[model samples]
Target: MDKLLSIVIPSYNAEKFLDNVLGELVKCHNLNRLDIMVINDGSTDQTAEIGQKYQDSYPGSVRLISKENGGYGSTINTGIAQANGRYFKVVDADDWLDSKNLDRFVGLLKRTETDLILTPFWAFNDKNHHKHIPEIKPDDISWGQKYYLKEQGICPVPSMHTYTLRTKLLQENEIQLDEHAYYVDIEYILYPIPYVKTFEFVNIPLYNYRVNQDNQSISMTNMRKNQQQHSLVVDHVNSYIKEHADGLNPNQQELMVNRLSRMIATQLKIIDLAPIQMATKHELSSFYRKVKDKYYFEPKDINLPMRWLIKSRFNLFPVIHYLAILKMQLVHY
Candidate 1:
């Protein structure tokens, strides 16, 4: 039987969580229609061993690929090349899908040929075990209705967790993400827009995204440590919008800009959260100037402090930094 969906697990040293991740998939009734690719990206621990165990147990449904430690994006590139299903999605090893929702999601894929599929996802905080679902679907859009991206008035921006692309759309376009890069998830989301013409929104919360882990890439400490990589991704997104602006329709252009604005805000926040230093202050000014000149982006959509920093042209950064610290201290007290 042809696989209906390919769930790629880009895992590295995920031994603590791989078992549960694979276990949920194996529980699905439609195993015959699901392809689970466990790409073990050069883990020194037992990641490969755990994946191998699942492969041995599930036979055709699960396959393990082991390669050198390239970053998260390389594992996705490998998965795209090796995918044998009609639809493709990436599920981090630390995250798992809702087993109850798997059959229905696959059923939807089996019937629809939309270039993109959007589904709501659960953000699970590991620290407190609280699950929050973002309002991904706009109230106007009916569930299961196919809409053309070019004609749609309001389109929701999808995170890596909330989207699935047609396998052929990716393979035909040769959609290769940045190799050995930290934040190429944004690249994966942005690079496919020009090729995507039709999409569907399903209200099912299929993905369970694990958050609030100290070692997670999106953590504040890691964001500061990897700020340079984040900036590189921002540059790639900016360049992509410029290179493809003529080809993208008005709606598509708006979508890309909204996404870029959010990335810029994040980069600014990373700078703001760091200790006041000459180098970081200089970075803040330079980044703000570049985006403003190139894209006419403003920081008005973010918090007040960030807006003030932008309004002052980042000159009052030191004052804002101390005031923010004081606010945090007062709140904690």
Candidate 2:
């Protein structure tokens, strides 16, 4: 029988959580419809062993792929190549799905023809034990109803963690993310925009996105260290939006604009957290000027430090970043 969904689990030294991840999935009523592919990306630990055990138990339903470490994007690239299911989803090794929502989500999958499926995801703060659902008002858009982004109202941008793209679309475009780099997830989400003609919103918060891990890509310290990789993705996305601007429909164009807005805001926060010397204010000024010149957002319109930073003509770079970091402490970038 053909599978409905290929849930790719990108694993690396994830043995601590791999069993729990598989254990929860195995409990799902629609397990038969799931192709659970665990990419053991150079796990020196027991991740491969545990994944093998599950594969042995579940046969084709669950499987493991071993490879040299090429980072998160490489594992996903491998999964896309191996997946045989109709729909594709990327689940981090440390993150797991909601078992109760599995059956209904799978049922939706069996009937969905939309190119993009957006669901809500929970940001589970590991240190604080607080859970946050990234807001997407499903009521604004009809469920299972196919529509172009312009005609329907979707909460501007959806997280990669909560989306499941059609396998055919990804493979057709040869969607390859930059391997061995952090922050490639944004590229994964934005690069596919031009190809996404139809979309569906599933209201369920199905993905449990574990947050606050010290070494996690989104962490402040990691983002500072991986700033080069971060810049790579930012530059790629900036150019991508420019290249596709006229090609996108009104709705698609708005969506892209909103997405870029959020992306720019996040980039500002990342820059704020970076250890830039006050003497090297030129670096911050140069970045600010380029982004401001690239997009036309009224500097005074939005209630963010970036707005003021944009308006200041780079003179306030040091003071602005100091203010931005204070807000970053409360919000997840």
Candidate 3:
């Protein structure tokens, strides 16, 4: 029998969380419509072994693919290629879905025939994280306005794992992951918005996104490559906005500039503060120059310290970073 849904989990050193996540997923009572694929992206640990075990235990329902490390984009592309289900979802190895809401989401997609179904998610802040907030209102929202109202609790971060996209829509649009580490969620979700025939947002938080100190997310660490990836993501988004600007009216354009500025500023912040080596400073500077002209907000608009960091990237960065570190040490001591 053909499957109704294909859940793709890209795993690499996810042994700590893979077992529990898969365990919860298989326990779904109405899994008759669901199929699973775990792409073991060169796991140096027992992730592949555990995935193989699940494949053995669940026979037809689960399958594992072993491949050399090709980053997340390749893993997702491989999973999409192998999926035979009518709909596809990309679930990160670290995150898990709420069993109760997962069923509801799938059922809604099946019945409503929407091109995409988006559900809200909670961010588990490993660094003094706060309580989860709900975003959906009864009022109808256009796809473009979602970002501007994020601060007012109306905008949502796409839980790439939580969304259920019609397989045909993805295949038709040829929407795939990019060579980015941090903003794959943004890129995938944003690229599909202009083409979506219909979209529905469920207020229920169906996924728990863990933001731990040890996590590889950009905000958690200061890796130079992550910073570069973010810069590339910003450029991609800018191009999208430019290409589709005609679709947005005046007010929407202003809102877009505001949202895009805030987003670009955040990415620049990562690049400016990253503990990057002097050798890679030019890449960061080059990216900053490319997007610097496009932002609605200028350097003076930002807070003083951030302004200093962005304006003085080449020379004063090391001095500022060291002083900030010293200041923190003094306070802690």
Candidate 4:
């Protein structure tokens, strides 16, 4: 019953954050039941030193895995494969969880056997002190409630930052994240659906995602530069939907396609960002056409454009995308 939650912290040049994050984690009420794996991802900073210190201090609870730089997704893959606990979660180097919520979650862990655990996370910028728990409301999912993926009524899918999957289930499915990639977190959030049997929503805000960090992939500048990587994830997910929809039941297929639809919509919006070069714009146009054509086969609940206004490659895209963005902003699509 104890030693249930394994938190994988991927640290690459995070000397500034190791002490505070590890310090807070080790002070949790159920420290004995926690397995904290700190992956030193080829860090040239003092991260390894600090990780070793904690490993020595809490010999059984904390362990450090030193590996070459393989980017964030690889670190998660390594950590998941090596986790000693039953439930698994990935906490960023810069983010920390609430200590009280950690205790409460530990309590719930002792009671529930849900395959996927959804919880609220505080999304905020620490510098400005603005924070809010993103509400999962379609008037369906209640906090601290239990439901299956095939459950009736749609609920907002929780972000990877606030989810804990069963370590055994993940390992059984052989979930391999894309190496050296950004936006792989979305892949993690969605790829586990085929295996998940039950889910429980823990309403307490447990995760603190510190936004506005440097080198962040979410910024418009980085998104423009790494837009292809974003597209790579969308392609992988959409491919799964296209190939595997037949094996699932009706409820499972509906949930899977709708969740994937939102993801495609989001990536389409990302592709529509401004200041892109002509070459990349042309590539995006082709990519969009391919994805839209693929989705055309199973267009049950997908809410994309009836017709994209691409006269030629990269030629009417900017104006068309501006209109799409404007429409989305005004109509909440």
Off by over 4 Å in 3: 125-162, 180-182, 223-225, 240-262, 274-289, 292-333
Q: How close is candidate 4 to the true structure, as a TM-score?
A: 0.86
Candidate number with the higher lDDT (2 or 4)? 2
Clashing pairs for predicted structure model 1, backbone only: none
Q: Please provide, for model 1 over 1-333, each residue's C-alpha lDDT reduced to its tens digit, 9 standing for 90 to 100.
A: 999999999999999999999999998999989999999999999999999999999988999999999989999999999999999999999999998899888888878899989898998978778888878887777888999888884444768898899999999988888878898999999898988999888888899998767787776678879998998989888888888888999878777887788788778877877788888789888878888888625355456777888888788888877775565434311
> Higher-TM-score candidate among 1 and 4?
1
Supply the TM-score for candidate 2.
0.90
lDDT of 3 by residue, 1-333 (tens): 667788888899889999877887887765767788999989899999999999999878788899988778778778777787787888888877777876776575465556666667766664665536444433546432232222222233344645777777777767767742656666665665555555556565667666544545643355344766766766777787687777754443443455456566566555545575774467457756776776444454344555676667756666655654454334311
- Flag the better candidate by lDDT, 3 or 4: 4
lDDT of each: 0.86, 0.80, 0.66, 0.77
Flag regions of model 2 displaced more than 4 Å.
Answer: 138-144, 153-155, 275-277, 293-303
Compute each candidate's TM-score over C-alphas: 0.92, 0.90, 0.73, 0.86
**Cα RMSD to the true fold for all candidates:** 2.8, 2.5, 6.0, 3.9
Between candidates 1 and 2, the one scoring higher on lDDT is 1
**Stretches > 4 Å off in candidate 4:** 274-285, 296-333
**Model 4 agreement with the true structure over 1-333: per-residue lDDT tens digits:** 468999999999999988988998998989999999999999999999999999999988999899999989899999989987889999999889888889889888888889988788887765576777777544666777777666643444657877899999889888888889888897788677777878777777788888765467876568768877887877787777666676665555666667676666556556767555686476666666786677622334444352343334446567766775566434310
Compose the digit string of candidate 2's lDDT tens values, residues 1-333: 889999999998998899888998989898888999999999999999999999999996998999999998899999999998999999887888998898889988877799998888888987888898877655566655677765764546677887889998899988888899888888778777778888877777789888877778776677678877887777777777787887877666666667666666666666766565764466666776787787633343345666766667656667876776665567753
Whichever of 1 and 4 has more lDDT, that candidate is 1
lDDT of 4 at 268: 56
Q: TM-score: which is higher, 2 or 3? A: 2
Order of models, best TM-score first: 1, 2, 4, 3
